[model samples]
Target: MNPPNVQYISECFIKPKSSADEDETKQPIIHLAPWDVAMLSSHYIQKGLLFVKPSSMNDQENTVQPLLEKLKESLSLTLAHFYPLAGRLATSKQESPPHYSVYIDNNNSPGARFIHAAVNLTVSDILSPVDVPLVVQSFFDHDRAINHDGHTLSLLSIQVTQLIDGIFIGCSINHVVVDGTSYWHFFNAWSDIFMTNNSSISRPPPVLNRYSHVLNLPFTHHDQFVGRYEAPPLRERIFHLSAESVAKLKGKANGECQTNRISSLQSVSALIWRCITRTRRLPYDQETSCRMAVNNRTRIEPPLPEGYFGNSLQIVRGIAKAGELLEQGLGWAAWRLREAVANHTDKAVREWMEEWLQKPFTYQLGRFFDPCSVMVGSSPRFEMFGNEFGMGRAVAIRSGYANKFDGKVTTYPGYEGGGSMDLEVCLLPESMRDLESDREFMDAVCI
Candidate 1:
């Protein structure tokens, strides 16, 4: 399969609308919490590509010279409110605790990288869901080009790729700055501005105070989590589960418990966990864990504001023996997954934060090679199809990161909608081969 040819037209930084403070020597350096600092060692950046149909000439009197022009203009205006996206993460060379903070030095650093490019392809070609990695790579630069050596920095990167009958909005955001929720918030905000042709619409102002939620960690724990773990070679495959299949899975998961009802997320995650374990042929007694990304917006005490940005995420893991999860049925695994999610309450989040402050980076520091662990990310709640920019809503959406870790799962809303889900599953080549031929897994997935 040949990769799509994407021609890079131009690359320039989109500065904020107001550059009056560019000459100011003293700038704000937003402090980061322990959770934010932990990601620095992992060096994981979030990348996604959104595909929108071609704009109808009648939609906007066709007055907007080009879509890229409007996008850049609106993005400049949008960055005024979300300025952190325009900044970089860095540390002042202090003798004591390296002051790691978001540097908003306007004179020294440009806001975000915006690339204008085009591809010779159609919307249908992308929506087909084949050659996904090739298409994704052509549009987005997941290289994390920004130097993260704590000395040099660049935070966000945006690339607007134009197709024959569509447009692709590619974004690469540093994981230290924002999580999934904040990622979509900035995206939707950009779309809203472009749609309404008004930068002053009723949008939730972003909360930039990184110190608001502090995780005071000990200085000694700084070196505790340092080494970056290498992952095994993996392949990415997208599995679509129809709404009917999801309902059946949910029903089966709930059947195990007479009292508690299992959620769609829990049911779907449990099925993936079981399928991966069985496909890998892991020993029956071998312990495996499913780490689900939990948003702490509502789980935090008093709850964060409506548009509080930053990394407000925590991964909750559900552990069980490989044989136990595969043998016990979907309900049993779902029950365990449900309990893991339920345990992330307001108090639990606070306690977890404090506990993390003690050990800090011990969790993800050197565990990338753990084949027994599956990291489930993304949520159907953030429906990418509903994201309507000035031209049109996104027909297909995908992440650009080549998830190197084995057993990593990312979920998105399927084309059929109505609770249907598309799981972008990544695993070792051998395990993926087994999973592709697994009868039970195939029966549950909608072809």
Candidate 2:
């Protein structure tokens, strides 16, 4: 590629000829949250660079564009498939309307806000530091060619780049329409179809139906819900964690509190709050909350059919204080975390979701809470690592998007020399570094 030139491409507009006209056969890609769609556009346009190296014929360098177009076209056929992996922190209201947007909506960014995922192929011209920004900008700039109305629909910038030599493919999905697995299934299936010229072999039709008849919650009748976390001004640092440190935190928390059903994740999060409070050294009885994300798929009956893409995550928070969470050892915080998660999960959690599932788009989750809230979300339940066509089994796989909130946390079970559970974890950068530096933090989780 010539030394990249950043051009604000000449733009044009199109009034798709009576597109959604009286055509019953044509399904609308539902616009879950127009605000979130816009938020993702603004965020990804700034840093959504996911480099991909061509592997099989479908991903061959010369043919990437057509495949990209095809993927978007297919995805556009549903109402629930607009923005890719976007999430919202709006104050959670009394009801949970079809939550499908995958993105974070904090008004801040000092570090990158891209949603990076890899395809593990080797290719030339992987982006170098100086030019990374330029290449990343190109993907969003060319949105016109991809989806002209990308801005309007919250499906703006996305980068498809070559990583490694030609054995790996990196992709930064604009956290709008697709979440983690949705992108995997979408791209993998697209590759499967393109490689064979059939869009349906072993592919399942996407389930975009959010039937009102099914959501039988006693809603507050049009109660407007604002987001839980308001968009904060960009921070000087980006919030992301590496897999190595997450493992250590889990071990440290375990060392302190040896208990049942106590996930390493909860322990690590508790430790994070504890450490941050200590460093900041805040006062006693000062409360804080960790926004815990829960996937409602398995919890829901019939377990939404495979490939049923949309926002399926729900938030349950772990509450502790500036003094309590801060002063307590890892074990104490971990125990409290365990209780918080467990208490919400009993019988009340399901009913809570049932009701919250019917709220309006502006639903803010913060209205229902306390102090020092840290938002968190997790990657898919199980890794979707078997979409291989020719390259040997995947050697590595993990999420590329960061939580991006001031006190945000998100994780994925890392893949090392693994099977069902050699769990590797990632955390916000600062917290991870703290875990590595502090011996107490380190020993608490037994890292």
Candidate 3:
């Protein structure tokens, strides 16, 4: 099959419908916390949902154009609550070595970029294939932009592509500005406004205040982490785990460890880690790791508000020797993962923040590119298919071509909506082929 061509229709910057008090001349300059600064080296988080057009639109003369206008209008209102997303990153080198911060000049906000495009493919063209089609990458803007690029580029970019029988809404959010949780928060809010035909969002508004007590240091490592990352040739595939399969894995994990504490995520992570390590054929003595992004909102002493926005994540890892990890079976591996999460307590979070302040460093993608390492991102807990933007619920979810590397895994709630999950795994060409054919790995995967 030929790659679907996306023809651009129009492009515009959609600013917030409402601004801050006009009398205030100085806009708030939000400084980046240690956690936010750590993502300076990462790429934008690109995700999208595929929705089949509502049956009511079958008789409309112009379906997509009107929907595009509605989306843009609702997005403008949504920006009122998430105003910082419409702003840009600013840096001042005069401060000895320079520091980075988000400058929301509401009066002159650049606004989020909105692009309208059309593709000649159906939703099945994207969701039917075992391997996601490369053309799907064209649905998103900022294909290779990193979080640092937010300084010059739009902090957020939304693309609405009109498919033959459906529509795809793709968003590219700066990783430095928000993590996966906040990303979906904004998405849900936008959809709510559109679905209800209300200008104001009914959901919990985002809390924009920075958590200052955690880190009192300034972010001055701008130049140290500025560059474009070129990922090597990689193949991406989504593996589905049914609710029953997940339960079985969880049961097996708990039974082996003689405990019932291992969660479904830990069990799944353990399974992937072991499968990838075994497929890579690493040495028995090689140390392999499974890194998971832990949300710090609830891990701190005084938990940040559920609506608290911005980056508040810490990467925790479960490390074990390759031979021991596979030999111990699934339960032992899951126990290691669970222990990693349990160890990242409030004290551990604060200590890590303090250490980062003293000697600042950013997360380099190379650390996760290690063949023996697997990094799990995104979560099934997110409202993946719940964003009903007046049209309908999302039938499927997909990610764009940013930040993908070997052993990178993104988890999403399956469309079936139970405890089911979809693991979007990226790996080297050869390793992916081996994994597809590996009987042990394929046995747990649901068709």
Candidate 4:
């Protein structure tokens, strides 16, 4: 399919309209935790959902204007609760103890960017394709901007694309401010405000306070964390695994191990790891790794509040030799992943935090560029299909061109609304072609 032309109609900044009575002169500065600082070099998180226009609207030609008005208005109300997004990242100029903070001076603040665009395409143009169209990347702002760019750029940017028969709402959020959990929390809250026509979110409001235990460390040599990341040429494809396939994988994994502790996620992660290793044709004795992002909300000594709104994640890696991984079958790989997750306890998290303070470092794109490794991000358990903003449930979900590299895999719940899963796999062009033709891998993929 040809790339559709996206005509930008207008753009403006949407400021937060607070519902609470507070002094604008003394807005608190939010401090960044170690987990948050670790993502400074990574790109902004870009995600969006596709919604069909409702049949209740009578005006055809004037529909988009009203929809844009409603979205912008509700976004203002949503930002009142998520005010940090309306601010920018500020760094202290001192050379000794580098300080990074999110500064929100309510008196004078640069608001989040809201863009309105029109696309001459249909819902089928996005959802019906075997591979997601490259044009989908245009639905979002801040194409390749990293989180560090928030120092000069908007911490949050939203784009609402009007299609012929649908709407696409995409967001680019600074990863230093929030992780995947917080990302979806804000999304669901915004949808709730719009759906209920309320000035405040219906769900429990987000806890904006920084974690108390994380020490404010003076991170040196911060120059490495600020810059644009240029990724290699790659191909992105979504592979679907139905409920039956997931169950079969779980059963097979557990059967091989003669235990029922292995979960559907671990099973599927193992399957992808092995398939990618085979497709890459790595040396038999080469050491390969699978890194999974684990949410640390529940893994800490004192659990964070229910809606703790910040980065509370840790990446746990499971390593094995290429030959052992492919030869031992699925269950062994699943067990290795399970062991990795189980080992990331409260003690481990605290130890890592302490170590990070001693030697501060951020995740660079090179860390994930290896064909012999896979980094699994996002989660199938997120409420991807629940963002109903008065139109209907989202028909599909898509992402932009940020933080994408070979061996990067993101998981989402299938739109089928079952236990089905969708894996958005990014790989080199040649390896992608090889994986698509691999019978063992393609057998589990649903059309």
lDDT of each: 0.72, 0.42, 0.85, 0.85
Q: Would you list the clashing residue pairs of candidate 1?
A: none
- Give the range where candidate 4 is weakest over 10 consecutive residues by summed lDDT: 99-108
Per-candidate TM equals: 0.88, 0.57, 0.94, 0.94
Q: What's the C-alpha lDDT at position 7 in model 1?
A: 90
Backbone clash count for every predicted candidate, in the order shown: 0, 93, 0, 0
Write down the lDDT that model 4 would get: 0.85
User: For model 3, where is the 10-residue window of minimal lDDT?
Assistant: 99-108
Model 2 off-target regions past 4 Å?
1-151, 154-158, 161-188, 191-198, 201-205, 213-256, 301-307, 353-371, 380-403, 413-447
Error of 4 at 157 (Å): 1.1
* TM-score: model 2 vs. ground truth: 0.57
- State the lDDT of candidate 2 residue by residue for 1-447, as single tens digits: 444533231222111112334234433334443323222322221222132333444544454445444434433332122222222222223435532332232222111122222233232333332112223223332232211123333333233343434333334444444444455555556345544544354667555443323222232432222122433432222223344555555666677677455676676667556665554444677677766666555656657677666445456667777776766777777777677666654355457644445542332324443335655454424444443433434443433322334454444343341312222223334544554566554444322
lDDT (Cα, tens digit) per residue for candidate 3, span 176-243: 88999999999999988888878777777788877453333355556656656688988989899999
CA shift of 406, model 4, Å: 0.6
